[model samples]
Target: MSIPAEKVRERLHALRSRMEKKHIQTVILWDPDNQYYFSGFKAISYSRPIVYWIYEQQTAYIIPELEDLHAEENAYTDSFHVYHERYNKGSNDTSFLDPFIRLLQNLPSDTRIGVEYEVMPAYVYQAVLDHGHDVVDIGEDIIDLRSVKDEEEIKWLDEAGRLSDVALDASFRHLKTGMSELEFDSYGDQAFLQAASEKYPEVVVGYENWTCSGIRRSAMPHLHSSTRTFESGDPVVHSRQVWINGYRAENERTFLFKDQATEEQKKLLKLAVDAQQAGMQAVKPGVRACDVDLAAYEVIKEAGFEDYIDHRIGHGLGLSEHEEPYLRFDNERILKEGMVYTIEPGIYVPGVGGFRHSDTVIVTADGSRSITHYPRSYEEMLIE
Candidate 1:
């Protein structure tokens, strides 16, 4: 679904207020997701270097000729400057940097510009400095702005969550021995695409899936789906991230082949489920982020499986697959209502395989509720 223009206007107004407090004159958003958050435009790829400019009075985009019409149709920017590629438009700006540098020169000498320090390219950062503009890191401010979901944003996230559950159901329904990991992922891909097309015609919907099968692959946590066939007792970790209209929901499940599953494998899977539940139960407004992680960590620790833990309990989720304000042992950020997160506490044992289940959750007025609701119990995960 298209983002409401009123939402974009409200976002810009809020950002400009932040800018005024910081005494910043302009902001350059290099990250595609950040650009989308502020301007309501996102490109398929940024290989050609699309730049978004947020000024005190107006916002603008510097894009390639190919995206001139696309940006005009989707963007909420006040103006756009087209950079050309073909030889026919030689007189126009040839490179993205050409227009970017020109625009920087137009600003006042002492203009305090804001940029995303984590993602802005060094050359781009240097260009602003060379033109006598001071740059401040506004990345955190943008993260804070996006961390809380607005009513419209939450609606899209809810839709994405429902779609993810649908995809997982399709994948698990066709699970069987001998199918390749890629083949297993294909079942859900087909189901997800068909469901999205039928339910929301013309709305932007996409997904990513990876199936790590067998003990070795599943133990590693992150890997692409391979052609290796599922064995009689192979443990499989299936991950799917679904996005609709730029908002994302992550859903994952680790299942065991019941035919030849070991007792230890079953126990490990149960621990993972218990840990995830603990993490979810800990999520509420006014709770420290670290407290949530520790709540889950303590579950595995009490079971003597603390050594198997390799990652944090969860992370903030929204426009990006993984966002800031993570739920980690070191993070002390307080949880707040309207914030969305993934509660995924994982354990990877060398011989037992990895066990984890992830579900996207939104922090409610009092506690939290998971949006992706595929069955996750040990009994439900056992695939015969």
Candidate 2:
């Protein structure tokens, strides 16, 4: 059940309405996530510099001429503007900016244009400014609209959640003691690809397991592919994902070795889990984002482990790993219906390692829904 193109158009129309309210005649989307959110086309080439322009009447795309046919075949834009160069007698011809300038000329002169300053390059900014048009920063305005998910987006997110669950289940079932951290990570990686292929053929997965054991586990956060091997009592952190129909859902869980966790270690893990639950329960429409952080902070504080809380309780999650409307102590943004975020509360002690339990959640009309369903209790930590 992929989202229909017409629904994407409707969402863009709504965005155009917002542009009109802001007195913006055009918007240039340069970020890959924003491009996918507006165009419904997922291509890794989007990681490079690209532009998606939306005018009052139509949508346009400026991409290398090499990608022209593919863009048209995918219906990436209503109109395509291509850029190419001609080779002559040992000298190259055609400036890259020529096509961009030509496209700019088609737009109305003196029109107030909006650009995503955060992602747009400095040269692009200069080129637009050189065109004698009124350019305004509209990055925040665009992000505000994107922070809240629509009905269609939530459906895709739900599908992504189900895919992640399948991946995690397979990975956990394959776990074994004495395996190197990379070995365990390979199992999870293969599991994600296998699950995504069965569920959504268009999906692509990224990120790797942050598996660590023994002394390395004591680090606050781990990264991909280390040489550490899993010992009997080593705490393990596995971060995995599933990209369903181009939508991403992430989940991280901590596992304790069988009969290996000390009483203190077990207690700390429980506190971290409880704090994560409190944060999730605090999600609701109209609540301040900071309040969600407080929910988890209060719990950890009462347990006399406030100092171990090193990061924000959670953050906004969507197409990209991190997005807007962050759930942090300093962020005063109000939570609204259709917003999706993660609630990950962690406690880290230098010699004892850390415990983190995270789940992606969506803000519903009445309250909220946890998109992730992987087991979260100590009893469920038993991999074998």
The top-ranked prediction according to TM-score is 1
Clashing pairs in 2: none
Model 2, runs deviating above 4 Å: 1-3, 46-48, 85-96, 201-208, 258-260, 382-384
Candidate models: Cα lDDT each = 0.91, 0.77
| Candidate 2 Cα deviation (angstroms), residue 346 | 1.5
lDDT of 1: 0.91
lDDT of 1 by residue, 259-328 (tens): 8989999999999999999999999999999999999999999999999999999999999989999999
TM-score of each: 0.98, 0.90
Model 2: lDDT to the true structure: 0.77
lDDT score, candidate 1, position 360? 91
lDDT of 1 at 273: 93
Please list all clashing residue pairs in model 1, or write none if there are none.
none
Off by over 4 Å in 1: none
- Candidate 2 on 1-384: residue-level lDDT in tens? 334788778778888888889899988877877877788654557433457888888888876656666566565478866655555523231454665777788778878999988878899889999989999888887688788887777777887787677767776877778788777777767776776677655544554356656635644565665777777766777776556655667788888785676777777778888898899999999999999999999999999999988889888887777788789999999999989888988788877777887889999988999888999987677444
Error of 2 at 200 (Å): 3.9
